[model samples]
Target: MWRRFTTVVGRVIPGAGSRCRKRGWVTPVTVVILGLSFLWTGTLADSNTPRQSVLRVLAWPGYADDDWVQAFEKRFHAKVEVTIVDSDEALWAQMHSAVPPPFDVLAANTAEIARYAQAGMLSPLDLTKIPNRRWQQPFFQRLSDIRGLVNAGHAYAIPFTWSSMGLIYDRKQFAVAPSSMRVMWDPRYRGKVLDFNSAQHNFSFAALALGYPDPFHLTPGQMRDVARELVNLRRNLLTYYTLPEEATALFVQHHAALMFGNYGTQQVEQLRKAGVDVGYVMPDEGALAWLDCWAITRNASNLDLAHQWLDYMQEPEIGKQLTQREGLANTMMPVPGGASDAGPKLVWLQLVENIGQREALWQRIESGDRLRTFPQ
Candidate 1:
């Protein structure tokens, strides 16, 4: 067993959105989510051996809190080490790093899990080891129905959380909710818009605004069109933000008229807690949404422990806690009348046509490139 321990430190921001931040850490550290004290400290060189049966996890900021981690550790009689990541790019980098995969299990979106499984970095799950699947709602239990969870007669990921990226606007600014995503580019809201700084979602949102039938699978010609649209969007945006907290700060500081809320209701809860009355609208073309799942790593040192972690997360109480504490919807059961499910039409995320093309175009847009660079 790999016996390595590092300290993961973070600050206690005021609301739910505060957990999402651009992670800046010197070295890999494992945070023991005990009382879940949000402490901020610079990188510390504390080299100590972890106790036996360490189950390292890679998850989003709010996914692995103290309550769940502590309970999981107690139930499984293992030491839990969590690594918080802000973006799918971070998850990719950590898993594909030169070092052996540092995490035993990871929570990622359906698209990402597919990419990882394609790369042969994920392990086929032993369903018999995870008894909690029976307790999940039918939507989650039937992996065969979900497009990306099962591949070639093998289960690779377990459904966990799901939400969407909707158009969020200041209720005070608009007496009525903006009915279309095009409102963000209305020139009226120019310099008052905040957009997510993600290559995949940005491209898809632009396609949606352009009325493309398949936003995720844009043609090369459509790609160029989307790129041009994004450039126009860049001109309107005060700035691009990666994390929900940053978006919240920008919205309040700049008095932003609108934003593309990537975290869905979590962002709404955060903004409300921060004293902002915002309205979330699914644009006429529908909004981009995602289903995040948990998967065991191919390099997991303790495969059984990893399965136990998945089972623990599927428990109804744990799912409820996730919704209550983090404002995200879990798949353990249907979200019955909650902000998590109250949104515009959700266009579930699909595998993109070409991530490389999107990233290249996104870089140009971010660098202030002219629209003429796109294929005319």
Candidate 2:
């Protein structure tokens, strides 16, 4: 059951930050939870303190894998209920709306956190209850050092996995596929290209191509320039798939020449098992970096159990399982003694939070107005 759950949550793979843009989806009341059992049917909490058996979590497909819930319940002696978010927008709507804090914790990326904190939807860290907080990493330390980090100037969330966006491709097809973002738009491979699942990714990739240092810092003119280019690519695109696994599948089935994927090497291997040939590369300009964290939601009924669950996950053994099951990298620990480097890119992406530019760029891309890359 847990493996089945992982399979679903694994789809989100990696993307987004702390607060997801709410413009995308109009959330439904009945959140579809994976890895669900009788775990959340009843309330199991200690009267003296907050003891919760059922935990409501809004996560992408595989974040609530049954294995995780079963392990957590067995170790902490509690039940957890998970809701699989349909899209990034939907998960964030749950965070900002008048909706109650349905889940005890969120396995969301860091970029999305700032939005949640600003909306007064998220709470500060109750670090005392969690043991993982004690095993902090230096990389995380530097991130927190940045002045005025979202949640009340304190990190309410704990970093779990870390990755940057890079290219994963097929070796058999491109004996010499360059890491440059231009390859996706190259006319020689025109209709064979597939792009990243998000607008930020789309525009940022173009920004890099246009020689911009930061995608988020683009001026209006630069944005328009990139938008036109995106629109053109959309026209030539085979399909715009959001799932990491799906991106990999495009290559496995020979439906696409290249895809915008940063991690999930397991898919590459799986494709190989089925006789698909592929490889991954990070372009010279670079890719985006992402951090997935575990945070407690305000009003979460089983806060204490959630903290315990976090502690259990921080344990190397459990963290290892998470990394193995999902292709994303974790911040809790360094890559084990011997691990492959087929993760995402090395450069941190300039995340776009501005709604106006974001929408315009995506619209232009979808409209096929200016994109033209495959220099013939």
Whose lDDT is greatest here? 1
lDDT of 2 by residue, 189-285 (tens): 7667666546666777788877787776777778777776776565446666554555555555544667676444544544556576667666887
TM-score for every candidate vs. truth? 0.85, 0.76
Question: What TM-score would you give candidate 1 relative to the actual structure?
Answer: 0.85
Report the C-alpha lDDT of model 1 over 294-364, residue by residue, as the tens digit: 99999999998999999888888888888887678888657433323334467777789888888888877
TM-score of 2: 0.76
State the C-alpha lDDT per candidate: 0.77, 0.59
The candidate that wins on TM-score is: 1
Looking at candidate 1, the ten consecutive residues that score lowest on lDDT are 22-31
